[model samples]
Target: MQFKKYRPYERVENIQRDWPNNHITQAPIYCSVDLRDGNQALVNPLGIEQKLEYFNTLVKMGFKQIEVSYPSASETDFGFTRMLIEDNLVPDDVAIQILIPAKKEWIKRSVEAMQGVKNGIFHLYNPTNEFQRRVVFNKSDEEIMNMAVESMQYLVELTQEFQGNVTYQYSPESFSQTQLDFALTICNKVIDVVNPTTDKKMIINLPNTLEACTANVYADRIEWMSKRLNKREAVILSVHPHNDRGTSVASAELAVLAGAQKVEGTLFGNGERAGNLDVVNFAFNIYSQGVDPKLDLSMIDEVKAMYEKQTQLQVHPRHPFVGDMIFTAFSGGHQDAIKKGLDYYRKEHCQEWNVPYLPIDPKDIKRGYEKVIRVNSQSGKGGVAFIISEFLGEELSKEEAIAFGHMVKQKSDEVQRELSKEEIIALYQNSNRV
Candidate 1:
């Protein structure tokens, strides 16, 4: 957990006073979509070499399960899958996942991608919604249901004959748009037909691919399905949410609270429309709440680099915990608090010296950022006065603040700068910092 443990302190630092966590569960098991969703987002799709590099990078970063690619789409995709299987680069505990539609041809191609593998996940799904059926494919519910059944039937046949390598999986593609009861009935029926048990390990992924509804309602449906889906103990309940309405992260989080065990999304919210749930944000969220997110987040930079290579888009420095702005404090008062907090932390135990300077230390995750205690247009005397007195190893009085205000004005006009209190202090702090 990134947060500090409760101790016998006289003061109770209430985090809720600043930013409350109304969420019951902080994080879920992350299945990064950097390879599939991030790659697909780019105008120039990542090449085989680029894709392979990223694929290996995420695995190295300790992502045990990842959505590698969409097989049954093109030869380039097929080649990548073949390379993932042929190169034997997949780790023992790692499950290389592939997405396929609920069609016989697509299912076969998806299974073909699974050949000669050790332990891999085959994520098979079909459109079980009204809009997708009417607009995307123009298929009726009966037709869609038949396709689902037939595809699942073939998948069952294939998985049975398949070796110790393959694992069975399915998702009700665009499940959020489908009627809840119909989706549940279809999902339950598929479970009955497949009858995947502990011995024959399986997973059912219910993807909230479109953020068309409220998170609570979606979570209710997920919980209802998870509870009613008559499966043995070993079945893994997974969730994949798309952020069309900016509710994907909440939906994904609430799913775990509602009994989901696995989650799928792209790094930094890269996806087709608005985007997917950001796995990094999701991970740090839960870690702050005292739960193990099961991610080696120290390799966040490497994962981000791979994402950039896969999609030529620079990572936003101000995105979140990994963002450049995450650890920075622009306000002079804030910076002074941070500086004092660090100073006190150096001489005193953090538990003893309670301060609200930061949520988590920047260095804990290897980020090279400090509190920005600078004088700027929006700066004030409290900030400037603090920096001034501290740098000189003496306390600057109210009298000094008035005198320093002149020096601040002089420097501001000279440098064509705005001397915030801290900036003014830095400029004339006993000439040591200056």
Candidate 2:
């Protein structure tokens, strides 16, 4: 591998950084882009019916904003948008968003597709990085700025003819790679033309089209832009981070501390390349810290099942928050600590969740305690006692638990695997101690 082929990203300097001391005190506005960003990345994209199903699931999960489709890009996307409008499936509080390139014909088609929807966000994007300017579009800075300004003007004019409430969202694609000065200039120009008021605020989404630097650098950029954008109070600072470098979650969190008010992501980080930030992971991170995530994730299992069925993508068993074995304990030490914590939690009747090795209460997400501890070759007395107490309603003293633990360890070693709860129960039931 030629390690010298890559160049380091430029670092932000000379700015009085405040994000380091700041903390996220509230949940940001979450927008699920599962239907558009996540669906487009699939090898076989979802059909209209499947898209509708996913859309309904997101609405029920308490997402107030959802990017439903890109209407001008595909017939399936357009049809799905129409189906939601025609069937009146969208809730009164939900805002359905659609993405479109900053072009005349495409913007017109997007507007037409959203004719009957009550609440809509028309998302416009154009590539603004130096590479895209020199290599992709081959346009000068003045020309690129003109393109964004003209697109915003056209969108503003078209909204008057449409019958629903329409909000404007703009993204300078590849924003993490764009020069900070140029990115801010283009956004300010677009904002000037849009003339957003306090009552009707615009959204300026800074997307990490590709993760180009460390999470702190992204936070620095966000803070710089938030502080410099024209009419800061009249615009909602938003972020859409992709996980090319596996740091999208950190970037999103720091961006919030840096003054971002909105986040756009998929359910399980499913998107192009490494995918977008996982909204479930981000929200649950907040939930674990005693802050309300503002999303009803109690039915996480059902949500994961529907997502897999529609996307044909399996969730990793160790994925955070929704993974099957995320809260399970196997090591003897960990099992002992968790068992004691659970016992203390029940004995004290505590309202706050505090358990060793478990960040959040599994019951909060509809997970049961049945699989919290499993016996294996590394089994210990605490786990054996836990299994006996939980399954058979019996507790063993320290001596008995220790002796039985050794037997279970031997059995597990002979099988070279973890022992199931039922197998452990049978072994205990057949034991001379029983």
Candidate 3:
């Protein structure tokens, strides 16, 4: 497989690292790029009607910022932007972000698309990584820097013509791969030109674009940039991590601890390639840790249904948080422990959740306890006893439970599959031991 052909990513050195000791005490500002990043990656992108439906879902789910589309990219994108504005579909508190390239024509069209919106973020991006600059654009360092600076200047001028409140967002498209010093240089240059104040802050988004390194490296880069950027308080440090390395969630978490205040991701990590960071997974992780994610995810099933319908993409059954099996337990020992924990929890009337095997209460996200345990060949007496007690409203003696457990195990082995609760109940009803 030529495994040795690939070289490891360079590690950050000589930096006083602090993110390892830091904890994310609060949720970051979440911006769903589902309509743009997620939609574009689909085999069939959503039409305007479907886009509106998804946008409404995101708004209801409590997102303050949503990247609707790249207006200048296509007619559909442009029309969606105007639809949200002219139709007054955007809520007063929500900001609709439109992506634009550093090109002048695209920026002009994007500005036109945002004409009457109350709150908008005009996002401008240019590739700055050495590979992209040399291979893709064949431009020198000065050329790339000038492109970003000039684009910001032009965007500032065009935004002044609009009547709506417009915020500026700049992404060094492949910031994770770009030289840290050069990345800082370009971002500071844009900030200098934009002259953002505390009242109106600009966003500097450091995107992992390809998720090239380990999560710790991403955190190191974020902390390094956060500490060094000029007018740091006047700029919101943001991260847009991709999942090429399957660590976007970890990278995003560490980045937040490192000082990023905004996160740009899709609902369930839908995007190009492996996909963008899964915002739902990231938020639920925080929620499990006792921090309020500030989003109502209690209707996760409904959200997943709409997302799959619109994008024509399926959420993996094993996907974290919203996955079907996330809260399900099949291991006999695990099921037994969970049963004991629930019993203890109810008897103590505990204010804090400390249930075994469950990080956060399943009911908190509108999931039921019906599937928490499933009988299999490895089934034990306690799990079988609990199932009988809960489903049949009958208590089994210790000896009876042990006898039934052996029978259930035999049945499961014969079928070579996990037994449903109904199947187990039927077996119990027909058993001579019963």
Candidate 4:
């Protein structure tokens, strides 16, 4: 007798209702810190022209705000921020922001760099958790919080004193690990100290510097905090998550759903350690769901390329969407279903619209038809036939399909990688051309 598979205990109706959605339609803002946070984490950051090119690329992709660099960190960072001024490449619509730790000296230099650019914001952050306070500074909680409060007040006063169109944002670094009530208390005190204007919203970016917990647990805390927040003069809750646990993007999505509005991340999740949350994945997630994510993400492949060239860091083929196999299916069953699905879908939807099975046809991205199908031990007959049709302009018979499939399996044992369309054609010609 055969045993039946175990059924899930969760309510199917609720699962359908509350299940995770790709945040495609959500109107959340995209803020890429590629030049600053992502670059700092890299083994080799971008040069002046590379930085300029990357910054311009981000702006073209519809990012209105970018964390360029903190001038105080190094002469290199300082000069790059200055190049934006000398070249006048800073867009009127886009605002450049800088990252300065919650220290007086760094704040001083960061403020100094803002002298030339008229439209710029300053994001001041400090380590507030017990671990950082204890390990890094060997200071008490009272001392650290007091320093943070004073730091925000100092930053606010500094910006006002300088007479500029600046906005203030502060993050409780490594915030996800902090206690619920303690984090709330610090956030409140920081906001009160900053006292931002209504027209210019104050952002309190709470970073999961390292993703240390589940998304829902973090969501619950954020929801609880948003309702409790007092100084509501246009406060934007922000999230910056690192991928230590490989759940940064999930946590960011849940946190946004929980209450956070603005998101801070790298474009392709390039950063120190395990890396930062991928805003492309996070942004497209919202886009594919039919919501306006407020980003022109069509040039994502270019962004990934620039990043790889600049940082000398390669993107994994398994990287979502822009990766190698995102739109390609190799499994026999998957290929069969996808082939039939496309045929049926094309009849109904406009030719401009992509089928539901694939987020995008690889050809749309200029990847060409040659690499679309790779026949291997795992790939099915439908996949082989689809590849054959792409190259030859006609369909293959079931018998012809099987004949080709056996050749693929035999060839698979010979070469390590899956056979390309060209190789398959060469094999077919070698045997049948005779």
Number of the top candidate by lDDT? 2
> Tens digit of lDDT per residue, candidate 1, span 140-253?
877877777778888878766655467667888888777766787777767777777788757888888777776767677777777668774657888889998788888877
Clash totals for all candidate models = 7, 0, 0, 9
lDDT of 4: 0.77
- lDDT string for model 4 (122-236, tens) is 8887887777788988998888788888888878877785454677888888787676567788888888887766787788888888676777666666666776675755788
List the candidate 3 regions with Cα displacement exceeding 4 Å.
none
**lDDT for predicted candidate 3 compared with the true structure:** 0.92
What lDDT does the true structure give each of the candidates? 0.72, 0.93, 0.92, 0.77
Weakest 10 consecutive residues of candidate 3 by summed lDDT:
365-374
**Candidate 2: segments with Cα more than 4 A from true spot:** none
Candidates 1 and 4: which is better by lDDT?
Answer: 4
Ranking 1 against 3 by lDDT, winner: 3
Candidate 1, residue 132: Cα displacement in angstroms equals 3.0
| Candidate 3 vs candidate 4, lDDT winner | 3
The digit string of per-residue lDDT tens for model 2 on 1-434 reads 99799999998989889999997778999999999999999999999889888988898889999999999999889988998999999999999999989999999999888988899999999999998998999999999989999998998898887677789999999999999999999999999988888998999999999998999999999999999999999999999999999999999999999999999999999999999999999999998898889999898899999999999999998999789999888999998899889989998999988899998888888888888898899869989999998888898998999999999999999999999999999999899774
Please give the ranking of all candidate structures by lDDT, highest first, separated by commas: 2, 3, 4, 1
List ranges where model 1 is wrong by over 4 Å.
1-27, 134-138, 351-357, 369-374, 381-426, 429-434
Candidate 1 local lDDT, residue 65: 84
Q: Residue 382 in candidate 2 has what lDDT? A: 89
**Per-residue lDDT of 139 in model 3:** 96
- Model 1 CA lDDT for position 74: 66
